[model samples]
Target: MTGSSSADQTVSDAPTAPGGRGLSPSALATGGLVALVGYASSVAVVIQGLAAVGADTAQITSGLVAVGFSMGLSAIWLAWTQRKPISVAWTTPGMALLAATGPVAGGFPAAVGAFLTVGALIMVAGLWRPLGRWIAAIPKPLANGMLAGLLLKLCLAPFMAIGQAPGLGLLVLATWAIVGRFARLYAVPAAVAVALAAMAMNPPVSGALPADPWPTLSLVAPAFTWEALVGLALPLFVVTMASQNIPGLAVLATFGYTPRVPPAFLATGFASALTAPLGAPTVNLAAITAAMCAGPDADPRPERRWQAAVTGGVGYIVLTALAAVTATLVTRSPPILIEAVAGLALIGAFGGSLLAAVQAEEERIPALVTLLVTASGLSFFGVGSAFWGLLFGGAMHVLHRWRPAGA
Candidate 1:
C-alpha cells in the first residue's frame, strides 16, 4: 500500500523545490530597470511620432496610457502562468514607422484604426491554429534577418548618445556591461546608480516637472479608418507575429521547454482586441526583452526564471502607479541616456536574433534582401519595413524556388 501510494504521488506531481531562494534578485531588478529605460525611450519616441502625425498631447497621452496599462497587465499575467520570466514591451519599430508615415498619411484616426485592425487580426491568429503554425514555419534565417534589420536603427541610439555625453553616458554603459558580465546581480543597480549620479552631478538640473506624479486614468475613445488598417494595422500585426511573437517562442525552445503556444497567442490576441478599443496597440509575445527575463542569467536553475518575471510585473505595477512620475522622470532624463541604456541592454538579444536570421542553406539571398530592405527604413503602400522586408524576401524566395538549377 505504501509503495502504491508513493507511485501515485510521483506520477501526479514532480517533486517541488524551494520557490523563492533561487534567482538573482538583482538580475530581476536589472531587467526591470531595463524595461523601465526601454519604456521611457520608446515613450519619448512615441511623443515625437504622435506630434509629427498632428496628435494633440492629451490624445497621445491617452492613447499611450491605454498602451501602458495593457502592457503592464499583460506582463503580469504572462509572468504568473509561465512561471518563466516573461515581459511585454512596446513596439519600438512599429512606432518609428508610424512616425515616419504619420504626418503625410491619414493622421491619428488612421493610426488608431490601424491599431484596432492589428488587434483583430491577432485575435484571428489565435483562433486559427494552422495560421499560427504557418507563421512558425517561416524559415528561421528569414525571421532572424528581419529581426536584426528591424532593430538596426533602435540599437545604434545608445552608442551614439554615449559619444555625445561622454561623462554620464559612458559611465552608465561601462557600469552596465561590467556588472552585467561579472556580478550579474548588480547590473540594474549599476544602471540606476549611474543615472542617479549623473542627475546629481550634471549642472543643468533645473528642468521643471509636471505637478501630478500619479496618472489619473480616464476612459479614451477610438476612431477607425480603412487607410489606417492597411498602413498601420496590417504591418504591425505581421511584425508582431513574425519578429516578436516568433522569436518569443524560440526563447522558450532554446531553454528546452515548449509552451501551449495557441493559448498564449490567443490570450494576448484577446488582450489586444479588448485594449484596441481603448487605443492601445496590439499585444503579442515579447522577443528580446522576454529573453532577458527568461535566460540562464535570470536564474541559475533556469526553471525558476519565472520568479524574475513576476518581480518585473510587480515593479511594472509600481511604475504604472506613478506613471505621472514616469512622464516627469522620463522627461528629465537626456535622450542620449535613454538611447544608450536601451542599446546596451539589447546587445545580447540582437546578436542572437541576427544569427538565427541568416542560418538557412538555400534562402540566404532572400534573407539578405529582408535584412537590407528592413534596415533601409523604407515603408511602402502604407506598410512598414518589416512588411516590405518580408514581401521582398518572400518574393525572392518564391522566385528562387521557380528558377531552374542551372538556368
Candidate 2:
C-alpha cells in the first residue's frame, strides 16, 4: 500500500506487447539490470554485516556465495513454478540490523544459530497465517523508526570518512552524487566501482586478500545462545518480515500478480536455513528489484514477466562466481572507506525510513522514542538496542492509545 501506488500507475500506463507469451529481449535486459543493480548496490553492506558478526574473510566469502546461490535458486524456482515475477534477495535491512548489532556473545557461530532461528521462524510464519499477520500488523512508524535507528551510524560513515580521509571519501561521494543525477539506480554501483579502484591502487596494510581467492564454502558449527536468540534472531526476523517480505509481496500485488504466499515464504525460509551454516544471514523476497522484474519494462505481458525473474535468477547464479573477488576487495579496502560506500548505498533507505518514522503525527512521539533509543545503542541483559527500542516504542504506543474504561 505504501510503496505500491506510483509504480502501479507506471505499469498501468505502459503499452502492451501484442505477441505470444515468451521470453523477450526486453525481459532479458531488464533482468540483467535487476541483478546488477541489486548486487552492486548492497554487496558492501552485506560484507560489513557479516564482518560485524565476527565472520572471518573465508567465512565472509562463504556467506556471500551461500546467499547468492540461495536467492538465485529460490527466485528461479518460485518464478518458474508460479509463473510470476517472484524475485528473492538477501535481506538488506536485516543485514543492516546485523551490522548495527555487532558481535554477539557467542560470535560467528552463534550468529549462524541466530540465522537458523530466523529461518525457522519464517517457515513457521508461512505455515501459520496468523504469525505472518502479526508481523505485518507491527506499526509502520515504529518499524521504520527501528530501521532508521539501525541505519543512523552507518549512514554517518560517508561524512565521517570525508573528515578522516577527504580524498577517498570525496571521490566516492562525488561519483555517487554525479552518477545519481543521471542514473539513480546505478549511483551506488558507480561509487562502488570508484572506491574499489582506489582501494586496489593502494591497499592498506591490515586489508589483505586471502591466500586462496577462489570461493569455497566453509561449514560453521552452529552455537546457540540466549543472547543471540534474544538480541539477534528476533530483531532479524522482525526486520526481514516487516521491511522485506511484506513490501515485496505488496509490490507483486500492485502488478496484479498474486503468487501463492506460503510457498514463497517456505522456499525462502528453507533456503535461508540451508545456507545458514555457511554463514549467510537470511534470504527473502526483494521489494525494489521485484518492481524491476514484474514491471511492464521487463515485458508488456504480465504473464511473461516471470521470465525476467528467471533471467534475473540466472544472473545471480552467475554472480556467485564473483564472491571471492568481491570479498577480497572488501577486505583490502580501508574499513572506513568501504563503510562510506555502504553508507552511500543506504542513504536513500535512511531518508525513506526517517520520513516514514515520523510521518504519522499521532505516532510521532513513540516513533521518535524508538529511533532515539535504537540510535543510543542501549543494551540490557545481553539484548541489543533494536529489540529494546521496539519494546519501549511499543509500550509508549500502547500507553498513548489506552483510555479509561467506557471513556
Candidate 3:
C-alpha cells in the first residue's frame, strides 16, 4: 500500500514539474519585469486603436479590463498546464491595423461584431487541422517580411518622437543604451521607468485625468454587417494570424518549446469573443514578450522557464487593477513619449524579423517585395497592406520556384 501511494504521488507530481518548483526569486523578477515592459510598451497603441474606433472613456476602460484579464488568465493557464513559457497578448499589429483602418461604415458596434468574427476565426484556426496546417505551411521568409513591413512604421516612431519631443526621446534612448550594456533583458523596462519619471518631472498641461483610476465596464452591442465582415473582420483575421500568431509560435519554437498551435488559438479566440462587447480587440500569442519569458535569463533550465511565464501571468493579473490608472496617465501624457517607448521596445523584434526575412537567398526578392508593400500601408477594396503583402510575396515565391535554373 505504501508503494502504491508513492507511485500515485510520483504521477501527480510529474505534470506540475513543468510549472516548475520553488518559484524562485529570479523567475519572479524576470516575469514581473517583462510583464511591466510589455504593458508599458504597447498599451498606448491599444488605447489609440479603441479611440479610433469611437470608444468612449468608460468603454475603453472596460476594454482594458477585459484585455488584461484575458491575457493574464490565459497566460497563467497555458504556462501552468503545458509547463512551457507560453505568453498570450493582444495583437499589436491588429491594433495598428484597426487604428489605420479607422472607423467602419457601421461604427463602433460594427467593429465589435468584427472583433467577434475575428475571435471565431481564430478559434477555427486552432481547432481546424486544415487551417492550422495552412498557417504552418506559410513560407517563413514571407511571414517575416510581412511582419517587418507591418512593424516598420511603428519602429520608426522613436526617430519621429525625437523630432517631436527631443529631450524626452533622447533621454529614453540614452537610458536604453546605457542599461542594455550590462543587463540586456531589463534595458527596455528600465528605459520605460525613466521615461515615466521624465513625464512626471514635466507633466503635460492638458490635465484631463479622471479623479478615480478604477475602470467601469461598458458593453457595446455587436452589429455585424457584410461590409464589416469584408473590410474589418477579414483583414484583422489575416494580419493577426500572419503577423502575430504565426510568428509568436515561431518565437517559442526557437526556444525549443513547440506548444500545440490549436489550444493557444482557441484560448485567445474564446477570450476575445467573450470580451468583444466590452470593446476589447483580438488577443493572440505574444511574439516579443514571449522571447523575454522563454529565454535563458528567465531560468537556467528550459523546463523550469515556464515559471517565468506563470509569474508574468500573475503580474499581468495584478496589473489589471491598475489599468484605469495607466490609461489615464498615458492618455494625458505627450504622445511622442509613448511612441518613443513603444518604438524602442519593438526595435529588437523588428531587427530579428528583418534578419529572418532576408536570411535565405531564394526568399530574398519575395521577402523584399513583402516588406515594401507592407510598409507602404497600401490598401485596396477594403483589404489592408499585410494581406496584400503576403499575397504578392507568395505569388512571387511561387513564380520564382517555377522558373528553370539559369533562366
Candidate 3, residues 244-285: lDDT per residue as tens digits? Answer: 787677556544566767788898899999999988888888
For each candidate, give its TM-score against the true structure.
0.74, 0.65, 0.77
**What local lDDT score does residue 233 receive in model 2, on the 0 to 100 scale?**
93
Give the runs in model 2 whose Cα sits over 4 Å from its true position: 1-20, 130-211, 328-407
Higher-TM-score candidate among 2 and 3? Answer: 3
Q: Which candidate is the best by lDDT?
A: 2
| Local accuracy of candidate 1 as per-residue lDDT tens digits, 1-407 | 00110011111112223653455664566457645764666676666665665566556555566666667677777666655556676666566666676653566666666676777776677677675565556655666666667656657866776678777777887788788788756665577667766754544433222346544443444566666666667767766775566656644443433455666666677666676555455656665566566555555555566666666656655666655456556666677786666566556556665665566568788888987897887755444566577778878888888968688
- The Cα error of candidate 2 at residue 234, in Å, is 0.7
After superposition, the stretches of candidate 1 with alpha carbons farther than 4 Å from their true spots are: 1-27, 49-59, 101-117, 140-158, 177-182, 196-210, 223-243, 246-258, 276-279, 350-378, 382-407
Q: Tell me the lDDT of model 1 at 364.
A: 83
Q: After superposition, how far is residue 293 of candidate 2 from its true place, in Å?
A: 1.0
Tens digits of per-residue lDDT for model 2, 169-235:
9999999899989976567668877886886787544432255657888899999999999999998
Determine the backbone clash count of candidate 2: 0
How close to the true structure is residue 166 of candidate 2, measured as C-alpha lDDT? 92
Q: Find the 10 residues in a row with the least total lDDT in model 3.
A: 1-10
